[model samples]
Target: MSERQRYAVLNLPAVPEVSAIKIVFNRRSAIIITFTTPEKEHIQG
Candidate 1:
């Protein structure tokens, strides 16, 4: 039997615009990434 190596890859798709990016630490102290897009503004208003 032969052993083969496995790998995992993560990629972010192209974004037209990244208005804002925020990094926060929650109660658990885990890093969280937040993205604010143009679409969000229309919904918020």
Candidate 2:
């Protein structure tokens, strides 16, 4: 197995009314990434 890289976490309460969240990753350089709650999961039969 291979090792995974680490990431930083940030929280924002500007828009508390909404049920959305954002995540940012600072790797190699400064970059921003966004993600929402109740993430998707895959199932295989």
Candidate 3:
């Protein structure tokens, strides 16, 4: 017999036209980050 996979859908709110987003990840005492602009451009650091 095989198990079924479940998935969930997330509905995110609309971002402001002039807003920017940032994401950060930490691994083994190192930090990686990403920046996003309102125009949907990704900046890596």
Report the lDDT of model 3 for residue 15.
48
lDDT of 3 by residue, 1-45 (tens): 112211111123444652553445466634344546666577666
| Off by more than 4 A, model 1 | 1-16, 41-45
Prediction RMSDs, each to the true structure: 9.4, 10.9, 8.7
Residue 36 of model 1 has an lDDT of 81
Error of 2 at 21 (Å): 1.3
- Sorted by lDDT (best first), the order is 1, 3, 2
Candidate 3 residue pairs in backbone clash: none
The regions of model 3 sitting more than 4 angstroms off are 1-18
For all predicted structures, in order, the TM-scores are 0.44, 0.25, 0.32
What lDDT would candidate 2 get against the real structure?
0.39
Instruction: Estimate the lDDT of model 3.
Output: 0.44
Winner by lDDT between candidate 3 and candidate 1: 1
Q: Among these predicted structures, which one has the highest lDDT?
A: 1
Question: What is candidate 2's lDDT per residue for 1-45, written digit by digit as tens?
Answer: 112323223333354443554444466545454534344332111
Model 3 poorest 10 in a row by lDDT: 1-10
